[model samples]
Target: MAPMGIRLSPVGVAVFCLLGVGIIYHLYAGVISSRIAALRRRRTVDLRELLALSVEAAVLGGREVKRAREENPLEKSNGKTKGGASEKIALGDQSSHRKMYHLIKNTFPFLQVNAEERAPAGGEEAGVWNHVIPADLQLVGEGREVSADDITVWIDPLDAAQEYTKNLQKYVTTMVCVAVSGVPVIGVIHKPFTEYTAWALVGSGSNLQPRAPRGGRSLRVIVSRSHAGKATRFIQTAFGNETVVHTAGGAGYKVLALLDPPDEQYEQADVYLHITYIKKRDVCAGNAILKALGGHMTTLKGEEIDYRAAEANHGGVLASVGRDHRALLAKLQSADSHRQS
Candidate 1:
């Protein structure tokens, strides 16, 4: 041992060991960082596929009618019926929600918790995304950084539960949307009955099949089937009697109708209008698809919906298929002004 050349001292051996450890740690960190970047790049596609699966699960679960009462329940003025026969109905909304949530969790355990759950119940914790960068990532246009905290997933397990219950299969849709820093980047709209799936990434065009031509005779408008209130009627009146109005359920359905209408009898909507407040889950997916098609969705005030806000949208929404947006906005403004005067 004493004859060995260049025998290192104790201090030198410790320094060499430290350097080796440092090198190993650095290499490990680099590998991890690279993996994260790759995952982020493919996140949009992954999410879209996952959403399609989840939507399918929701549709399957929603179709089950356990009891006749679940399909149609007799309404009573009070808890007790005149004949003293009480009935309980199984609501499709809750079952659809559970099915969709569990399907997604079983598929992608990483996105376990719902981002909308501000106060999660016992055993429910926030989703953990290890790949999410600690620092901001570029989203939307330039000069914007989407914080990791801003990333979230919005799901509408059953977009048109009312229609689903009524067996209006065409009106029902399962929607999933991904928002990076509150800006929707990926969206999936799946109709179980028709087996139609429409999806879109922020920069990429929509994957809507059977694309239809836009040229038509009249300015066709699509409005909410269930919640057609005064505001919606006012919008129709403002558009004038010449405009053709179609009633449909589900925000995704309305938007999809604009893209791929059923037949010549049903003309594609030029504008999808909602003149009342709606949850982000209702419109997030539709908005993303519309945007991918070179369309715009904004509030009556011409402001974009802030998905990051606790209340998804404060006012009405106007979604147009590229044309007539500015003209429609001007008419809406004029209508408001006339009403005020």
Candidate 2:
């Protein structure tokens, strides 16, 4: 049987083409609209939600950290880093780091993240998301628009490797910091062994309780235990002889001492003073947390650190809680004047 074909007139052909074009255009427009909606969702992230997510991620990472430590005890790592023992990664660190990296990436795919640990060393357990916002968190503004270019997430899966190696899990912490336009706006510090997490959103609020503020003379200063000799000498000369000096490991641990304080080695810290160059990730989270508490962190010369800088190294670190930040700097200045004469 021969097939019969219907030949279309010129006008009919034009109509058919227009119909095809219209269909294609509609499909394309639908796709574009969907894509735009997706982009908008990714671009706008609630700071509170980020804080909650960060706490969840940190808690999840902490589980891995504890498992790693228990499965295989960390022998003291032999190395050196800036101002303290070198950054030592163990089975726990790698696994925890990988877990944290994926969780944040999956949740906030559009964010640029900088993590201390890069790859997973071996097989490990995964984590579940529990978006936990603090009960006491009082968010500042209802909502503020944040552009994509202004946000970066900093992750340090295992903060106190040295202490961890020494079986001092008290100093160990898993940290996350969210910075916008070079300003750290959100921070989460989780103590794996203790199973406690502290989170803060800048210009918002945190769970930090009101404590009796301290300042001026008789200031209790906290410095790095690995290299405290120089710092102790400098701090005493700058502040005064009566200033109490306590030592601790891990920048995150030190910062925590400034807030709630620990009962042991790093006790009663009014301010955390590090007179050596250090990485931004080490301080970014703590800095954000302190900022939320109305505290301040700066360089030795009293200059604010721009967390967005490409070169992560900054010249020393000075963080003070409550009302003593400026006063500490002024005291240092006075000491400098006395020395110059």
Candidate 3:
């Protein structure tokens, strides 16, 4: 999900604990809200506004990523850390994720933020965060106003870090996704190298061109270039050897492949598969973007993911575009049954 080698360490735990704000505010603002009412309640939201702010937040994070690359401020961590969990981390990720979180907190401190990089418990000086919101941009249209309590912001400071470390600029991306009542409603993916951003507000519209129609004789499944052992075997077993599995870097990039044809000569993808470990931050933005285009993204079992889940989106993922999602799921199920028996 975060390139093969990169990982979200234990230090990357809930944001609330990092702030040292105590456990009282943890349920609504830090930990996943397991309340049945929180799950069932629906609130009218002007997703357009949140979508805009999220885009700005993503761009700010992208700037930090670029700076980190130029400054070579990358750092690695261990499995045990005072921050939260112990796992290898990047300084670029810390700075960028902090900036993204800082921006949102400054604007609206009450909103719950789910982030990959965990900062210190006390946080930076008062002068740390400064963000500028863009004034004019025709994004999403016509949405009912919603309360801030039901909003959750998801941020991935630097995706595809391994690729970026290797000077693979194209593979690097920064993403921001807004989830409302467990449903991802807005997504923003920004590429630092090209400075290009693609965003979507579900049920509204997007700034992207139409994706290439699904073609080719075999089912084209795009996957992580970093880790493909399981996905490759699954395609071979489930769809037979005729299936084409294209390997690339970053969840955002793979999702982009499903959206449109690459600048190169390769064919567009029908689905993006990750039959392995992946956190919600890894795929939530892509999920929102794909859904905006009228596509499907869910667990391998075809279950909708709750963004506020305590465990995060830990199961394997299967995302299909411009195809029969149910039919694909049905086929996958049949194959699994045969393999087990």
Candidate 4:
């Protein structure tokens, strides 16, 4: 009936129309899926970049603090300096922390950066991250939903304040760490003087930069540069005189030395031991990086340090390259027990 023997019945026309609709539907669905994937990738990148920026900001701000302290030396009494510019030195400890905090907030307005505030928790006033981190935020390594309450951000704008004021610039470090569900997942440490940065994202492994080989002839140990308290002495005694002890500053720097040691006398430290109490801000970033390198950082009893708490770590922290963590922890625990008795 059609021209040149070409003809279409009612059923044939219906089939053709259905095929067209199906093709269109599939194309539309594919476009939406692609867009969603792109958005997720963008978010992950944004979070990583934000963490890096926070560390960088802290480093830059630390320089300002160092200059202020140098310009106005600490007085013999009251620990205050006398000068118009020295006013910053009075607030040196908090200045860097505040600067990094504000920088993150201004740079990324979409992220609800919580202000550090005192709130009532467990029958006590506790400093907590006030904002709720969105659950949809993707954690780099762990494939799990992270609720707002389960995520916390820690910032140490300037570590080794005492060493920094004393012109021991090598020990100073600026660090930022992000923990989800009480586990550190992202960490960044920046040395302002060296301009060297060590960062780690859980499940992504350690930094790929060229680093000196770890392990040496002796059991290399890195202790606190400034605070050599009873804990340090006990660890030294526990390891016996054969161990090589290298004193350095900054918890982050100590961890870095373990990860990327120098080519000098002390190439690397096998263990980073801190016997005294330390704050979450002080060790969170370093511990995260260490864990990424297949290392372990825990208490003398071999328990993981909890980051969700409001208080500091009073028990002690032992970080090792995973070779002899059990033995080292046991030795330290035995020594601690002896001391207690």
Candidate 5:
């Protein structure tokens, strides 16, 4: 009405422009968020599928191992003695584990077993056509293989073969560790004989957390429910006299058995203990998940264990559960010295 023309106030113009930009940004953010959520969902689905396939293959492999055991028992009972005599055995039971590894490789041609083809980062490539790089969960999907940058998968076939050969109920076969870098974000342990598994994942949040498997409970160490050694006795003394114990074989099996209870026993019995002192392959994925969920794995010297280093296999691991576990570990160290002396 001022001059029969569209004259707008400065404030009005500023408000309108601001609203327009805000609206545009809001729409863009919504789109981006939707995409991110969709990608996450897809990834979850893919992970579930891959896990299912792995479990299935491992089960089949277990059957094969059982069959082999039945056909040719690893050890035979000595007629002269009531106890069975130890017999020479192969380094590895190569039947089920090796067969499955190659089978998975053959079936999924795109997936790189332990290494993949990649160009060198800086140097000029000459001797090799492609540089091999370690990948996390490189799976062959249909015609293409998906290479995830965030996730990693490590497989240790035949974790407790000695126990398996001995036909110990506690023996575990494959140990799978999922990690981001050297930190294990998830852990899976499968026992061939029982056809059971235990798994853990790093939960969501700013702190590293425990991701329990279906009907799974948090892990607790159980050192030789029956036989107690000097090292184990030292640990028990620190834990307390009433502390419960479970029988398990090998570090890998010991760790897994902590998560899984025998059918005759209770699922999870609450105690003051938490898992620490796990080996490289033993706690690789478990430690990753724990750290991601705000936990830490270190050595008896209170130094962080570097998974990439060869020293990870040397054992003598010390891990803490929550911040208070550090105190317990210190006491255990004292006990260790006492036992050593």
Candidate 6:
């Protein structure tokens, strides 16, 4: 029989307290999730707009390159200069390309603004945000800034220069990254040319969800199909020798490859990390999505990839599931050394 009075045991009281805390945490999580979702919506729209501008720039740059190439070198050589009386054409196609790149690069601040605006005054947020930027893409780890908020975006508007220059149908303009400070969270890789987008939200436990034009397919490791070099071989060996590598161009495409299904040419695997040189212009939009999802991203050497400095060689990147695969990285490093030797 039950007691008439409200007989509560000590354990019962403790359990009630725990339940109350859990309820509070649940509500807090809901609120935070909602805020994060709104941020993502705004950020994504901004990125798409920038990407459009970048593509336009690339098209215009291509025209310049073509015109410069056709600038009658023979006629200039035939003319006479002050020394030998010859007139130089000095067609500035390269200069035009640089201007186009800068146009896209300069637009990063608007996408993820500085974290200083959101951080508490006089807090320990210094050197934590990005404020520098890079001058070249061939190099790594340059020009970027650090902010109070732990978010970054990586974008490569025109990947596969050969394909892009050739006006190939398969080329991709991509944007992707490891969002937040270090965790590889949500990621978005969209192919503007094809109107295809791949996104994933990674947390403690990983779940692969899909978007339109396709159903939910599990996220996988997408690599360069054509550039099957020592690095690719090592990845295949670790994840599985038979792992399928997708040859999608562009940084954004690679990030998307982690989530997007394998088309007729590329088969998908079950792991991915969209690592990039720590640069703001290359990462902001994609970082927002990755953070919102769940996973985190960092350099292969396991340090915070700062965005405030402006140089290009921030070492390589490692983004994946489960725990950090240091062993795989070691293998790649070893392979690289062996190849060099």
Q: Largest TM-score belongs to which candidate?
A: 2
Model 5 is weakest, by summed lDDT over 10 consecutive residues, at 125-134
- Which regions of candidate 6 fall more than 4 Å away from where they truly are? 1-156, 168-171, 174-189, 197-220, 236-240, 261-266, 273-287, 311-313, 321-341
TM-score for each predicted model, relative to the true structure: 0.64, 0.79, 0.77, 0.67, 0.54, 0.42
Write the candidate numbers in order of decreasing TM-score. 2, 3, 4, 1, 5, 6
- Report the candidate with higher lDDT, 1 versus 3: 3
Q: Model 2, residue 202: displacement in angstroms?
A: 1.4
lDDT of 1 by residue, 63-145 (tens): 53222225654322224322122322225444555555554444444442353232122232222223331121222223223
Backbone clashes in each candidate structure, one number apiece?
0, 0, 7, 0, 12, 58
As for candidate 3, its clashing pairs are: 10-85, 11-84, 11-85, 44-145, 45-146, 79-86, 225-248
Give candidate 5's TM-score: 0.54
What tens-digit string does per-residue lDDT give for candidate 2 at 1-341? 89999999999999999999998766455434434454668487777777777887888889999998999985645467655557566778777887887676656657788876335424422333344555554344454557767888888888878788778888899999989989999988899887878887777677664346853448888998877898888889997789899998889998988888443444868889887778888899999988888888998778888877564555788898775577788877677677678
1-341: candidate 6 lDDT, tens digit per residue: 97689868999999999999998766555434444554554443222233234334444444443454345223122254222212233233233334344333343323432221111123111111122221221122222333324544333333433334434434444433334454434344444345444443333211233323222343345544344464466556445565555555433444444344443233333344333333343444344343444323345554445653333525555544333356546655665566557
Candidate 5 segments exceeding 4 Å error? 1-50, 76-92, 103-152, 204-221, 224-227, 236-246, 260-279, 285-298, 302-304, 309-312, 318-323, 336-341
Judge candidate 2 at residue 288 and give its lDDT: 93
What lDDT tens digits, residue by residue, belong to model 3 across residues 46-106? 5666777788888888998888888884556545533122344556777788778766665
Cα RMSD for candidates in order: 13.7, 9.9, 13.2, 16.9, 21.0, 23.4
Q: What lDDT is reached at residue 222 by model 5?
A: 47
Candidate 2 error regions (>4 Å): 1-42, 76-78, 117-145, 215-217, 261-266, 333-341
Model 1 misplacement above 4 A = 1-90, 105-148, 209-216, 227-232, 261-267
- Candidate 4 wrong stretches, greater than 4 Å: 1-50, 66-92, 107-147, 208-216, 227-229, 261-267
lDDT of 2: 0.77
For TM-score, candidate 2 versus 5, the one ahead is 2
